[model samples]
Target chain A: MDSTPAQVPEGEDLERRAAELHDAMLVVDGLQYSHWNRGVLEELRAGGLAAVHVTIAYHELARETLSRIGEWNRRYQVHADLIRPVREISDIRRARDEGRVGIFYGFQNCSPIEDDIDLVEIFRQLGVFVMQLTYNNQSLLGTGCYEEVDSGITRFGRQVIAEMNRVGMLVDMSHSAERSTLEAIELSRRPIVISHANPASFHPARRNKSDAVLRALAESGGLLGFSAYPFHLRGGSDCTLADYCDMIARTADLMGIEHIGIGTDLCQQQPAEVLTWMRNGRWARELDYGEGSAEQPDWPTQPDWFRNAADFPQLTRGLLAHGFSEDDIARIMGGNWYRILEDGTQPRSA
Target chain B: MDSTPAQVPEGEDLERRAAELHDAMLVVDGLQYSHWNRGVLEELRAGGLAAVHVTIAYHELARETLSRIGEWNRRYQVHADLIRPVREISDIRRARDEGRVGIFYGFQNCSPIEDDIDLVEIFRQLGVFVMQLTYNNQSLLGTGCYEEVDSGITRFGRQVIAEMNRVGMLVDMSHSAERSTLEAIELSRRPIVISHANPASFHPARRNKSDAVLRALAESGGLLGFSAYPFHLRGGSDCTLADYCDMIARTADLMGIEHIGIGTDLCQQQPAEVLTWMRNGRWARELDYGEGSAEQPDWPTQPDWFRNAADFPQLTRGLLAHGFSEDDIARIMGGNWYRILEDGTQPRSA
Candidate 1:
C-alpha cells in the first residue's frame, strides 16, 4: 500500500499543523527500547514524542539498569531542550507542557525486581512504571513467550501481580506466554496490558496474540499495543506505514474501538545485541529454537516500518488516509494508552 | 549484685580450665551492628570473637558496611585467620574450619530491601542473612516501635514475609512495633525472630516486648534473642552481669532452652553520630522522640552494664555462679541461636 499520498491540495498546511500539534501534544510511546544517546533522543524530539519508555531488562542489554538510568540523566543535561527522564504520568504532562521529550524508564524483564516483591515500589518511586513478568523464558514470576512449554504464572507471580496492583505499576505481558498472559489477565486486580503485540490477523506466530486476547483485554479495560516489528506484518517485504495502519484497522475491526494503539517497538537507536539478547532466555540460554549463528544479530532487519521518530507524522497521515476519523486517529496515536496509564497506574491510596 | 565472685577459692584448676575454655572456644558474637571500620574489626578480633554480625541496615552504620566488607576481603589477604564475610551456614562452618572470624552481614531494618520484595533474594545472595522489618519508625512493610499508632503488616508486607521465607532470610523484628511484630510472626511460614529484644522484665518501653508477644514468638517455634542494651536492663545503672544473668535465666526459664539465646546489642566502636543517626532515623529525619535535640548527638551515653566484646565471659561466669547448669549456659551463650540459624535461614531449595 502506498502510504504516502501524491499531490494533495491541503498537504502543505496539514503537514505544518500536524508538526505544530504533535509538538504541543503529550505524546507517549507505550513501549520502545533503543540504544538511546543524544542523537536518538534528538530524533524522538523531532518526531514530536513527549515520552518514550527506555527499556533495560533483557540479559543481552547492559548489566546495570541503574547505571543506564544515570546515563540518561547525564546525557539529557547536555540536551535539556530535547529530553528529560519522566517518573510519573504528571512528568509526562509536564514534559509536554515544556516541549521536552520525557523518558519513562522500564525493564522488559522482572529480573531487576530480583526476588523481592517490595522492590517493585522502590523502582516505581525511582521512575520505573512498566515491567514485563518475564523476558522470553520462565522466571520466578512466570513463563516467557519463547519457552517450549509455557507453565503460566507461578504462586510468587500471583503475589507479584497483587503487589504491582497495590503499588500502581502497569503490567506488560508483551513477551509473556499465552497461559501466563491469560492467567495475568484474570489475576490482576487492575487492567493487565499487552504493551506490544500483533493480532494473528497480521501474524500467526506465537509472538502475536489472537483477536480473542485483544478483545478480552479491551473487555477488561486494557489496551493492546500494536508492535512495529516487521515479522508481524502480513506482506513480508512489502510493508509501510499503510500496512501498519491496516493491521491497526483490522484490530479495530475485530476488537472494536478503544482496544488498540501503537507500541512502535521502535529501535531508532537500539543496537543489534539487544535483539540477540531477547532471543536467548538469560544472557545466552537458548530456548528450544534451533541453534542460531553467533555472527547474526538476534532479530532480522527492520522492514520499512516508518524509518525513525522523524517518520511519526507518516503514521498519523497514513491512518488519516485509511478513512479513520481524526478522533480515532488521536486515540490510536496515544490517547488510548494515556487512559490506561492514568487508570491502571494510579496508586490505590492516591 | 556484685558480678565478681563473693568468695574466691584461691587457684582452683577448674576455674583455670573455665577461663581457658572460654578463651579457646572461638566465641562468636552472633550479632553486633557497631558502626564498623578496620579499627572496630581489629578490636573484634582482638577481643577473640570468631565472627560478629556486621550490621548494614541501621541508617548510621552502613556507610562503611560495604567498605568494611572490602576491608575484610583485604584483611583476608593479610590475616586470613581473622575475618571473612559469611553468606551461608556453610560459611560459618568454613570460618570455624579455617579459624577465620566469620562476618555475617545483617540489616537492622528492611529499608535496604527498600520497596522491592525481589531484593530479598538479591541481598540474600549478597550475604545479608538477618533483616529487621522496621527499625524504629514507619517503613513500607510495617510500623516500628516509635510509630505512635502501630498498623500491622500491610498486604505488601505479607508477600514480603512470604518471599523472605522462600528466600531463606531471617526476619528480625527487634525494633519493630507490637502489631507489626505479631503480624510478621503470624504471616511468616518459617519461624520468624526478634533478633534482639527485651521483655518488660527490664523496661516498660515499646522497645521491649510484652510477655504475650515473647511467649507467642517462642511457642511458634521461633527464638527471642535477649538484648543487653542497658536502657532495657532492670535497675538501670545499678545493674551488673548477675542482673543480666538473672534476666537471661528468667527468659530461658520462660521460653525453654531451645527458644532462648543472647544478642548483646553491643555498640562498642560506634562513634556518637551512629547513635545520633539511630535516634534520628539516619540524619534524613529528626529524632522520632519529640523533645530530642536535633543538632546535638542526643543519644544517651553507652550504659556501664557492658563496655565491649571482652565482657561476654563474665556473663558465663556469672550464669554458672547463679547455679545454672553447664548445658543451659551453652544454650544461652550460642547453641540455641546456632540451632535457630540452621533451622530458619537455610534455603528452601536446600
Candidate 2:
C-alpha cells in the first residue's frame, strides 16, 4: 500500500540512479532498537547501512543495562564479519572499508546511570555514545513526552547535561517533552538530537516533536532524524514513499536539510511478544498497548515502500523526485549525521 | 526573621485557643526527607506531629531502598516510644494515641521500583504507601517539573500508573511536569497527590504546580499538601507567615478547603552538606545548585517562623488568623491528608 512520487523520473533509470546514490552515500540510521540477531545484522550489512546507533536499554537498570552491552560484545565476537562496534567516528570509515555495519551503543533511558552521576563517564568508557535522558516516560535527567506535566530538566539534570557534554556522550531527546527537549538543546554545551521523531504536525503522536522544537534543534546545531516508524508516519503502514518523503521535504523547510537524517526505528525480525518487553518492560502486571490498541497490539507493519534496511534506495529515489539536489540527498542520506557524530561525540580536552 | 500575622484576633486569647486546637488535632506533614537520627524523631514527637510521611529514597536503587526501610524497622524497635511505622491508615490514630509520630515510608523518585513493576506491590507490602512518580527530575514512571518539555504519560508510564493504582501505592507527583501531572491524574483509577509543592501562583519555581494542575488535582479527589520549602515561598527565608497563609487561603478559594493540607518539607536537623544528597545525589560529578545560587549553594534557611517540626502550632495560628473556621482549619492542617490517605492507600480485593 504505497505510491511512487507524483512524477518519478521515467522508470528503471530512476531506480538505477537511486541504487547508485545509496551505494555511494554513507547511510546511517541514528536509532535501531530491535530484537536483532545474526540475520538482522546480515540484513543491515547487505543493505549498506554503514553505521547505526543500537539501543541497549529500555527500562533496564544500570547492571541490566551493562548486561545488554555485554550481549552486544558477544554479538561483535560472533558476527565479526557482518558487524563491528564503532567506538570512535574514525571507526565507521574503518568498518566501511571492512564492509561491515558499524554499530554504536545507545540507551533509551538513563537507567544505565541510575543515581550515580559518575556512571556517565563509566558508560562512555563502555562505548555507549548516545543516550536519551528519557524514553517515553520521565527519566532521571528530564521529562519525557508522556508525563502529565512537562517538568523541565531537574537540578540533577543540569549536572548530567554538563557531565555528558564534558564526557563526550551525545544527548538524544527523541522521547522527551517539549520543554525538556528545548531546555536540553539550550542546556547542553554541545548539540543534542531528537534522533527518531517526526514533526507533531506530520502525525499527532506525542512521540513526535513540534515545529518549535525542530527549529530550536536546528538553531542549537542539533539533528532531527526523521522517523520511519509507522506510529510517527501519517497513515501508519499504509503510508506511501511519496507521503513520507513529502513529510521530510516539509520538515526540511522548517529545519534546514542539513539538520535532517533517517532513523527508521525498525524492529526487524522481532516477535510481537517482544513488544511486551518494550512497552511494558516488566513495569506492568497487565498488558500495555503502547502505540497499538488492544485489538491490534503488536509490532506495526513497516510500510511496503520502505520496509527494511534494503529499502534505502526507494528513499533516495523518492527524495530525487522531490527535487532535492544530489548533494542534499547525500546529506539527508548520511552525510549530515556523520558530521554531527564527529562533533557531538568528540571528548573535551582537560 | 519572622513577622507576626498582619493583624491578630486580639492577643493571648487567640494564641491559647490555637495551641489547644493544635494539641488536639492530627497534624500531618506529608514530606520530611532529612538526615534524621533518633534526636530528629524526638523533635517530631515533641512537636506533636501525630503522623508524617518520611522520605526513604531520593535516588536509591531497589535494594538500597529496602535497606533504608530496614533501617526504619530498626528505629521502630529501638525508639518505639518516639516513632511507629504506619502501614495502615488506621495506624495513624494508634500512633497518635501512643504519643508517637506515626511515620509512613515514601520515595521522592521511583528508584525503588527500578525496572520491576512488581516492586510497586512489594513496596506497598513493605509499608511504602506513598511514592512520587518523579522527584525534581524525570523518572522511569513520569516527567518532573525541571524538564524542558512535558512529554505526556509514556507507554511505560501508563503501565506504572495503572499498576500503582491497582497495588494501592499512592502516586505523588510533587515534582512532575504539568502535562505529566495532569495525565497521571487522568490515568490513575484512584486519586494521586502532589504531596509537597506550593501553587505556581505562590511562587514561580519549576517545582510548583500550576492552577490547572491544582484544579485537576482537586477535581480528581487528590490532595495538595502546601509546601513550606523556602524556595517555593514568596520571599524564600524571609517569607512572612501571613504571606504564606494568604497563598494557602487564595488556593483554598480555588481548590476548596477539603483538598488542601500542610506538607512542611522540613528536613529537620539535616546538616547543610546533606543538601548534596537531596539535590545533587551521586548523579552529578560537578556541584549542582538545585535551588540555591552558586554563591549560596547549600541548605536554604527555613523561614524563622516555621523552622522545624516545632513550628506546627505557628502554622495553625497563621491559618486561624487568615479567617478560616476552625473546622476548615483542621482540614487544611491535617484532616484532608488523613481522609485522602485513607482512600488512597486502601488495597483492592483480589
Model 2 error, position A304 (Å): 60
DockQ of each: 0.02, 0.01
TM-scores for every predicted model: 0.53, 0.51
User: Which is the leading candidate under TM-score?
Assistant: 1
Q: Write the per-residue lDDT of candidate 2 for residues B122-187, one digit (tens) a residue.
A: 567668888888876777777877788778778878888887776688889998889999999998
Task: Report how closely model 2 matches the true complex, as a DockQ value.
Answer: 0.01
lDDT of each: 0.70, 0.83
Model 2, runs deviating above 4 Å: A1-350, B1-7
**TM-scores for chain B, in order?**
0.87, 0.96
Estimate, for each residue in B133-159, the C-alpha lDDT of model 1 and write its tens digit.
888878788898878899989877888
